[model samples]
Target: MSLLLERHGQCLCGAVQLDCRLDNSDVSACHCQTCRRWGGGPLLAVECAQPPVIGGGDALGIHASSDWAERGFCIHCGTHLFYRLKAEPHYAIPVGLLEGEDWSLASEVFIEEKPAWYCFANQTRQLTGAELFAEHGQPDDA
Candidate 1:
């Protein structure tokens, strides 16, 4: 598959829209507690290559979820929009928010925090919470 793919998507109420180029077509899932609580399940993460073009008026709501990251949603529809680092321009968006092709489960982050109630059958690269922090830096620094 190509390294990058263009995609467009919007919130449930069409209040917020985004255009972006993504490097990974495979959608990764985040099992971190914050992600689980925020979205009511594992957060399907699709990282953007750069800042996305988000349009619409007064429809975006941003919450500083952590010292290093902030979460966004649609103010009108309450749809989860994105999870982005405060110091970085890139965004790790919910895979469900973007329209594209060739999507598959590639990896799972914060595997250690994943509850036993549900599990995916796909064999994927799994990383523990500490491992994620080790690679991306702790939540305070990541």
Candidate 2:
């Protein structure tokens, strides 16, 4: 499929809308408990260098999920919109948000913290939190 030049997404109640452009397809499935609790599964996300052009920005609620991460959602509908890196200025939008297409990006970043009851059958690279952080800089203590 064509790389997204512009993508459109909206919240559950349509109270928040976003338009964005992304170049990379490096998506990941985050299994951290925080992520699983927030989205009810591994969060499938893709990266965007620039913030999406948002409409009804007033309806969005942001929570600092960690020292460097924040979660954004619709206050009215409680739809998770995106997760952002507080220091990096980049964002990971839920793959479900891209209006009308099925796009498979890079699938990695699974935290071993995932419950044994669930297993990802996809042939994607699987890494625990420590592995992911080690690949970046230090090992994850979480």
Best by lDDT: 1
Q: What's the distance in Å from true for residue 140, model 2?
A: 2.4
Estimated TM-score for each candidate: 0.91, 0.84
Q: Which candidate comes out best when scored by TM-score?
A: 1
lDDT of 1 by residue, 16-59 (tens): 99998987687889999999999889998788999889998488
What's the lDDT for candidate 2?
0.79
Clashing pairs in 1: none
lDDT of 2 by residue, 59-115 (tens): 989999987679999999899999887756678889788775646645667556778
Pairs that collide, model 2: none
RMSD of each: 2.0, 2.7
